[model samples]
Target chain A: MSLHDCRKAFSETLVALAEADPRIVAVANDSIGSSNLKEFKKRFPERMVNVGIAEQNMVGVGAGLANGGLIPFVCGASCFLTGRALEQVKVDCGYSRSNVKLCGMSSGVAYGELGPTHHSIEDLAWTRAIANLTVVVPADPAETSSALRAAAAYEGPVFLRLSRMPVPDIHPADYRFEFGRAPWLRRGSDVTLIANGTMVARALEAAALLEADGIKAAVVNMSSVRPLDREAILEAAVAGPILTVEEHTVVGGLGGAVAEVVVQSHPARMRLLGFPGEFAPTGSPEFLFEHFGLNPEGIRRAAAQLVEESARVAHETHPVR
Target chain B: MPPDSVPTDAAAESVSAAKMARRIRRSALQMVHAARLGHPGGDLSAADILAALYTAVLRIDPRNPRMPDRDRFILSKGHCSAALYSTLAEAGYFPREWLREYMKPLSLLNGHPDRNKVAGVEANTGPLGHGLPIGAGAAKAAKITGASWRTFVLTGDGELQEGSNWEAAMAAAQFGLDNLTVIVDRNRLQQGDETERTVGLEPLAERWRAFGWAAREVDGHDLEVLIRTLRAVPFEPGKPSCVIARTHKGRGVSFMEDRVEWHHRVPTAEELSQALKELGGGDE
Candidate 1:
C-alpha cells in the first residue's frame, strides 16, 4: 500500500481552492510547515494570516475573517486548535455560525513521541459537542481533498480533522465525499467494522483478516462524525454486531458517536477499540497503534469477538425449544 | 465615505450623542430592572461609548445591517448586553420593544450578544478576549481586499486578563492592521475585586504600545471626546489603535457607580426609578 500524508492533500486542495476563489484564506498559529501551509503561503503571501503561536487568537481571527466576508481555513495542530482554544471553537466558530473552516492538523495520536499533550485524541469529542460546526475525519488523501472542497463550498463553520499519520488510499481515485454520509467500503453480515481517519485503512485490513477467518466483517468509513451517518449505522446494526476502531480514546470519539446511535435506534452488541482513558505512553505512531490494538490483527480479533457476542445475543433472544 | 458617518458639526453631534447616551442608560436600566438580571454596572459604564459609536462613528445603517462594506462594530465585553441592545434599538437595528424581552425565555436579546440573532452585532461575544482577534481579522481582511471599511471593538478593561487578547494584539501590530480600533472601557473593576488588585493592567497604554499599537486614553463618559477620539482612529499611520477610555463602573446611577457588587447585580424597583430619575427619565 502506498502511504500518503493527508496534510499534503489539505494544503494542495486549499491552494487550489484559493487560486479559484479570492475569498479563500488561511489562518495559522505559526504552524506553516507542520500544517503543510508553506506552499499556501508561498503562493498567496497576502492571504496567509499567521498569528504566531496563538491558537485562541488564530481561531478567533478565523471567525473575524468570516465575519468580514472571507472564508478562512484556520489551520493549527489539533491539540492546540481543539484543546487549547476549545471555547473559541465553541463560541466564535460554533455559536456565531461563522464561515470558518478549522483545519485540525496532525489529529489523534499523530504526534507519536510528543506524548499525550501533543495528541489530539479528544478533538472529535470536543468539536462534535459544539452545535453548527461540522466535524469531518477523512480516511485518505482523496477523501481529504474531497472533504476540504466540500467544506469550502458549504457555508457555516467546519472542523476538518486531518492526520499526519500516513495511510494508503481507501477510496477509488474518483471518490467524492458527501457530508454526513457514511459509505460502506467492504460489505459483510457477521459483524460491521466502523472506523475513520487512520483507523479506516487498518479496519479494512482487519476486515480482510476476518474474511480469511471466514467471518464476514463489513467495513464502513464513518468520516463525518457530527452529522453522523445514522442510516448507515442502523443498517449495519441490522446486519450484525458493530466493532468501532479509531486513533482516539474509546470515549466520545467515533466509537461513542456510533454507540449513541445504536443505543438510541437499534440495540446491538459492540466492541470499541481505541486508547481507553490513559494517555499514550512513549512510542512512535506505529508502535502506539500496534500497542493499542489499532492494527489489522487486533481489529480482526475484536470484530470476531463482537460477531460471537452478536450470535450469542441473538440465540439468547430466540430459541428453538 | 458612508452616508451620515462624517460629522458636519462636532458640538451638535456631541449634544445629540449625550442625549442618546442618556436614553441608552435609561433603556439599559429599564431592561435590567424588567429582566431582574444583568451587568448594570458595565452597561452604565459602556453606554456612552456605544451611543457615540452608533450615532457618530460607525458607518452602519440600521436599515441594512449586513451591507458588505459597512464598518464593523463588536461589543467584546458582551455581558453588557443591556447597553448594546439599547444602543442597537435606539439606532434602529431592531425596535425598542425588544429591550422588554431582555433575558426572557427565548428572547432574541440573549444575555450575551449573538450576531446571528441581532442585526447590528458583528461577533457573538460574552466571553472576554474574543473580540480583539476577531476585530483584527476583520481589519486584516479590509487590508487584504483594500476595502475602506473599518472595524471597531469595545472590550471591558478587566476582561483583558484572558491571554488571548495579547496574542491578537501581537498579530494586529505585526500585520499593521491600521483599520482596527480597540476601545477599552477601563472601569477598573471585575466580578470579584478591582482589576488593579486582581490582575493589575496599570501600565495599560504602554503595554498596548509594546504590543505595537498606537495607544491613548480618554474620559469614557464624555460623548464628544469619545466620538472625536474614535473618529480619529489609527493614531499612527501603520498600526492598530487602542483607546483606553477611563470610566466608572456605573456612570449614571448614584448608588451603583464604581461598585463591584453591581457587576452582575439586579436593582430593585425603587433603585430603578431613582436611577432613571438621575438619567432624566421617568422609567420609560
Candidate 2:
C-alpha cells in the first residue's frame, strides 16, 4: 500500500475529477504547490486559477468561477482560507449556494511550528455553524479521494478539510462515498471512538491499544460533520459510551456536533477530545498532539476511561447482565 | 445630463415604472411599519431605481424566477431589503401579502435577502459588497453559454468603500462583462456620518471609469430618467455600465431628507403619517 499524504490525495483526486469533467476548475491563493496542484496546472492550465496571496479575492473568484458554469475547487492553507475570507464564504458561497468546493489544506496544528496564527483548529466550528453548508473532514488518502468525488457530485456549497499528515489508507479503493454519511470502521458493543481527518488514524490506533487491555472499542470515521450521521451516532451511543476525537476545537467542531446528536437521541455518557479551546504554543505538530493528548496513546487512555465509566454504570443498574 | 434628454421610451413601460415606484414605496413602508424594525431611509432612497429595473428594464418572470435564460438582478446593499422585497412582490415574484411577514422570526423576508427563501432574489447579500462579483459571474455565465441574458447589480455609494467591491470591480473589468450593469444609490450618507466624511468617493465616477466601466450620473428620484438610463445599458460596448444615481438619503419623506440620523432610525407615528402623505396615493 502506498503511504500518501492527504494533500497528495487531494491533488490526485482533483486531477482525476477534472479529467472526467471539463467544468472542474482549481482556484488557489498562490498555494498550488502547497495544495499539490502542479500536475493539475500542467494538465489543464486554463482551469487552474492562482489568485496570488489575496485570500478574500481568491474565495470570491471561486464563487464567480462556480457561477460561470464551472465547478471550482477552492484550495488554500486552512488558516487564511477560513479566517481571512470568512465573510466571502458566508455570503458568496454559502448564502448563494454556489457549487463551490472549499478545500482547506494542512488543517489543525499541521503548521504548528509556524505558530498559532497558522493553525486552523477553528475551521470546523466556524463552517459548521453556517446554514446550507456541508462540512467534511476526510480520515485518510482513500477517504480523501472519496471526499473529493463526493464534493464534485454534491450540488451545493461544501467545505473539505484535507490534512497534511501522512496517513495509511483506511478505506477500500472502490469505497463509495456519500455526503452527510459517517463510515463505521469497527463494530463493537463496548465503546465508540468517533473521529475524522488526522484524528481517525489516531482513533484506530487507540482502538487497537484498547483491545490489548482486554477492552473492546468501536471505531467510526465521522467524515461529515454538518449533516451528522445521526442514525450511526445513535446506534453507537446505544451500544456503549461514546468518545469523540478531532483536530479541532471541542466547542463547536465534530465533537460538539456529535454530542448534539447523541444528547438528543440516546443521552449517553461521552468524552469530548480535541484542542481544549485555546491557542497552542509554538511546537511541532507531533508535540502539540501529544501535549493536547490527541495522539493514539492519549486517545486510548480517554477511551479506556469512558469504557470503565460505562461498565460501572451498567453493573450498578443491572448486576446480572 | 438633462432629465428630458435622458434616453427612455415614453411607452407603457414608463407608465409601469411610475406605478411600480409608488407601489414599492408603499409596500416598503408597510413592511417596515409592521415589523416595527428596518432600514427605511435607504429603502426609500433606492425604491425608484428598483422600480425602474423590475417594471421597465430587467427581463424576469415571476412564475419562473429560476429560469436560466432570465435576466438577474442582485441587490448588493442588502440592508435595504424592504425595498427589494416590496419590489419583488410588486413584480409578482410572490404574493404581496408576504410583505406582512417581513422581519418576523423565521420569515423568508429576513432583514437581508435569502435566495432560497424568497423568489426573485438572485443572491443572499446582507453583509455588503458581495452582489457585484456574483452578478459578474452570472454575466460571465451568460457569455460562456452565449445567452443574451444580462445581469444588473445595485450598490450603495457608501458600500463602494468596502474593499471587496473593488476586488469585484477589478475582476468585472478584467472579464469585460458588457452584459453587467452596476447602479449606485449615491445618497451621500452612511449610518452615523456622511459618506463623504467617513470615506470619500468624491471622484467616484472617475474611479469607476479608471476601473474600465462606462460611467454615468443621474437623479435617483427621477423615475423617467432612471427608466431611460437603465434601458440604455452597456452604454459602451465591451465595458460594464455604472450608473451613479444621485439621491437623498431619505427621499419623499419631509423630515428624513439628507439627515444622517435617519439612515436607519425608525419614524414615530406622526412622522409616519407625514411620510405616507408625501408618498401621496391613497391605499387601493
Candidate 3:
C-alpha cells in the first residue's frame, strides 16, 4: 500500500468539473498553495476567486456567488473554514440554502505539530449540527474525487472534508461515492468497527489484526456524517457491539455521529476511539494517532475488548439457553 | 428635492422616487407601530435610499424579479426590514398588504430579508457586514459569465465595524468588480450609541477609497442626489463603486430623528399619530 495525498485528486477532479461546466467557480481564501489549487488557477484563472486571507468574506462570497446563478466551491483550511466562519456557514449556506460546495482541506490533525489552533478536530461536530448541509469525510483519493463529483451534482450546500495526510487507496478506481450509505468493507458478525476519513484504512487494518486473534470483526466506512446511514448502523448493531474510530475528538465527530444513530435505534455496546475532549499535544499526525489509540493495533485492542464486553453481558442475560 | 432640479427624465424619476420615499417612510412607521417591534430609526434613515435604488436605479421587473438581466439589491442593514418591505410592496414585488404582517408569527416577511421567501430579495441578510461580500460575488459572477446586470448592497453606517466588510472591500477591488455598488447608510447611530462615539467611521469615504473603490458621499435622504449618484455605475471603469449615503437615523420624524433609543423603540399611539401627521398621514 502506498500513501497518496487526497488534495491531488480533489484539485484534478475540480479542474475537470470546471472544464465541463461553466457554472463551476472556485473561491479560495489565500490558500492556493496549501489547498493545491495552483493547477486549477492555472487552467481556470478567471474562475478562481482568491479572497485573500478572509474566511468569513470567502464564505459570504461563496454564498453570494451561489445566489448569482453560479456554483462555487469554497475551499480553505478546515479549522478556519468551519470554525472561524461558522455563522456564515449556518446563515448563508444552511439557512439561506445556497448551492455551495465547501471543500475543507487539511482536516483532522493533518496539520498536527502546527498546534491545536490549526487542527480541525472540531469541524465535524460544528458542521454536523447545522441543517441543510451534507457533511462528507472521504477516506482516500478515489473516494475524495467521487465525493467532489457528488457534491457538485447535488444542489444546496455540501461540505467535503479532505485531508492532507497521505493514505493508501482504500476504494477501487471505479468507486462510486453515495452521500448517505455506510458500505460494509469487511463483513464479520463478531463486532462492527465503523470509521471514516484516515481512520477507515486503520479500521480495516485493525479488522485484519482482530482476525489474526480469531476475532471476526467487521469494518464499515461510514463517511457521510450528517445524513447518517441508519440502516447500515442498525444492521451492524444487530451483529454485536460496535467500535467507532475517527481522526477527531470523541465529542461530536464521526464516533459521536455514529452513536447518535445507534443508541436511538440499535442500542449496541460501543467504545468511541478518538481524542477524548482534549487538545493534542505537540506531535506528528502518525505519533498522535498512536498516542490516542487510532492505529490498527490500538483499534483491534479496543474492538476486541468491546466484543468481550458484549459477549459477557449476553452470557449473563441468556444464561446458556 | 425641487421638481426642476434636473432635466425631464431625471427630474420626473426623482420626483416619483421622492414620493415613493415618503410613502416608504410612512408605511414603515405604521408597520413598526403595528408590530410593536422594529428598528424605526434605521428604517426611516434608509427609506429614501431604498426608494431611490428600488425605483430610479435598479432595472428590476416586479413581475419577473428573478429575470437574468434584472439588477440585484441586498439590504445589508436588514433590521430596517419595515422600510424595505414597504419599498418592495410599493414597487409591486408583492401585494402591499404583506407589509401589515411585518414581524408577525410565521410570516414570510421575517425581521430580515429572505430570498427564498420574498420576491425581489436578492439575498438573505440580517447580520452586519454580509451584503457586500455576497454582492461582490454576484458582480464577479456577472464579470465571469459576461452577464449585463449590476448588483447593489445597502449597509448601515455602524455595520462597518465588522472586519468582514473590509475583507469584502479589499476583494471587490482586487477582482475589480466595476458592476457592483455598495451604499452605506451613514446614519451615525447604532442600537446603543452614535457611530462616532462607538467605533468612529469618520474617514469613511477615505476608508473605502483606500480599499480600491471609487468612493463618494451623498445626502442619503435627497432623492435627486441619491438617484443621480446611484445611476452612475462603476464611478471608475476598473474599480468597484462605494456611495457613502449621509443620512440621519429616524430622518422623517422630528422627535425620533437622531435619537438613539428609537433605534428599535416602538411608538406610543399619540407618537405614532404625530409621526403619521408629520409624514402627511399614514397608509393613505
Candidate 4:
C-alpha cells in the first residue's frame, strides 16, 4: 500500500478547480506553507488572501467574501481555526448560512509532537454543534479531493477536516464520494468496526486480524460525521457489537455520532476507542496512536473483548433457551 | 479639515435630519417599550447616524436591496437593532407595521439584525467586532473584481475592545482597501460602565491612524457633516477611511442620555410618554 498526503491532493485539486471557476479564492491566516497553498498562490495570486495570524478575522472575511458573491476557501491550522473562531463560525457562517468553505488542516493528533494544544480532537464536537454547517472528515487522498469538490459545488457552509499524517489509499481510484453516506470497506457478520480519517486504514487491518482469530469483522468508513449515515449504522448494529474507532476523543466525535444514531434507532452494545478526554503527552503521531490503543492489534483486541462481553450478556439473559 | 467641518447645505439638511432623527428615536423607543426588552440607549444614540445613512447618504434602492452595484451597510453594534429596524422601515425597506413585532415570537425583526430574514439587512450581526472584517472583505472583493461599489460598517466604541477588529483593521490597511469605510459610534458608554473607564479607547482617531487608515472625528448627531463626510470616500488615496462619530449613549431621550442603566433597559409607560413628548409629539 502506498502512503499519500491528503493535503497534496487537496491543494492540487483546488488549483485545477480554480482554473475553471474565477470565484474560487483561498483565504488563510498566515498558513500558506502549512496549508500547502504556495502553488495555489503562485497560480492565482489575485485569488489568495493571507490574513496574518488572525483566525477570527479570517473566518469573518471568508463570510464577507461569500456575501460579495465570491467563494472563499478559508484554511488554517485545525486547532486555532476552530477554537479561536468558533463564534465566528457559529454566527457568521452557520447561523447566517454563509457559503464559506472552512478547511481545517492537520486535524486530530496529526500534529502529535507539538502536544495537546495543536491536537484538534475537539474540533468535530465544536463544529458539529452548529446548525447549517456540514462537517466532513475524508479518510484518504482520493476522498479528500472528492469531498473538496463536493463542498465547493454545494452552496452553504462546510467544514472540511483534513489530516496531515500520511494515510494509505484505501478507496479505489474511481471511487465516488457521497455526503451523509457510510460505505462498507469490508463486510462481515460477527462484529462491525466503524472508523474515519487515519483510523480507517487501521480498522481494515484490524478486520484482517479479527478474521484470523475466527471473527468476521465488518469495516465501515464513516467520513461525513455531521449528517451521519443512520441507515448504515442501523444495518451494522443488527450484525453484532459495533466498535467505533477514531483519531479524536471518545466524546462528540465519530464514536459519539454513531452512538447517537444507534441509541435512538436501534439500541446496541458498542465500544468507543479514541482519546479519553485528556491532554495527550508529547509523542509522534504513530506513537500517539499506539499509546492510545488505536493500532491494528489494539483494535482487534478491543473487538474481541466487545464480542465476548456481548455473548456473555446474551447467554446470561436467556439461559437454556 | 477640522472635525466640525460643515457642508453648504448644513442648515437645510440638519432641519430635515433632525425631524427624521426624532421620528427614528420615537419609533425605536416604542419598539423597545412594547417588547419590554432591548438596548434603548444604543438605539437612541445611533438614530442620527442611521437616519443620515438611510436617507441622505446610502446609494440603495428600497425596491431592490440586493442590486449588484448597490453599496453595502453593516451595523456591527447589533444591540442597536431597534434603531436599524426603525430606520429600515422608515426608509421603506419593509412595512412600518413590522416594528410592532420587534422581539416578538417568530418576528422577522430579531433581537439582532438577521440578513436572511430582513430585506435591507446586508449582514446578520449581533456580536461585536464582526462587521469591520466583513466590510473589509466586501471591499476587497470589489477591488478584486474592479467594481465601483463601496462598503460601509458601523461599530460601537466599546465594541473595539475585541482584538478581531484590530486584526481586520491591519488587513484593511495592508490591502489598501480604499473602498471600505468604518464609522465608530463613539458613544463613550458600554453595558456596565463608560468605555474609557471600562477599557480606555481614548486617542481613538489616532489609534486608527496608527493602523494606517485615514482617521477623522465628527459630531455624530450633526447630520449634514455626517452626510458630507460619508460622501467623501477614501479620505485619502490608498487607505481605508475611519470616521469617529462622537455621540451620547442615549441622544434624544433626556432621562436616558449617557446613562449606563438604560443600555438594556425598557422604558416604563410614564417614561415612554415623556420620551415621546421630548422627541416631538405622541407616537405615530
How does the DockQ of candidate 2 come out? Answer: 0.40
Q: State the lDDT of candidate 1 residue by residue for B1-284, as single tens digits.
A: 24654465666788888888899889888898889899999999998898888888889878999998899998999899999999989889899988899999999999999988999999999889999989999999998899999999999998899999999999999999989999999999999999999989989999999989999999998888888899899799999999999999999888999999999899899998888888785543
Q: Which CAPRI category fits model 2?
A: acceptable
Give the DockQ (C-alpha) for candidate 1: 0.89
lDDT of 2 by residue, A174-221 (tens): 887787788889877788999999988789889989889988888998
Q: Whole-model lDDT for model 2 versus the true structure?
A: 0.85
TM-score of each: 0.98, 0.89, 0.97, 0.97
| Share of true Cα-Cα contacts across chains kept by each model | 0.81, 0.43, 0.69, 0.59
The residue pairs found clashing in candidate 2 are none
- lDDT to native, each model: 0.91, 0.85, 0.90, 0.91
Query: How well does candidate 2 score on lDDT at residue A132?
Result: 80
lDDT for model 1 comes to: 0.91
Model 3 over residues A1-321: C-alpha lDDT tens digits? 799999999999999999999999999999999999999999999999999999999999999888889999999999999999998998889888899999999999998899999999999999999999999999999999999999999989999999999999999999999989978899898999999999999999999999999999999999999799999999988888899999999998888888888888879898999998999999999999999998899999999899888889989999896
The CAPRI class of candidate 3 is: medium
As a whole number from 0 to 100, the lDDT of residue A22 in candidate 2 is: 84
Give residue A25's lDDT in candidate 4 (0 to 100): 95
Task: Select the stronger candidate by DockQ from 2 and 3.
Answer: 3
For candidate 3, lDDT tens digit of each residue in B1-284? 21113334666788788888889988888899999998999999998898888767887788888887778888888888899899989988899999889889999999898888999888888988888888888899899999888999999989999998999999999988999999999989988998889889989999899899999999888888888899887799999999999999989789999899999999999998899898883544
Q: Give the TM-score of candidate 2.
A: 0.89
Candidate number with greatest TM-score: 1
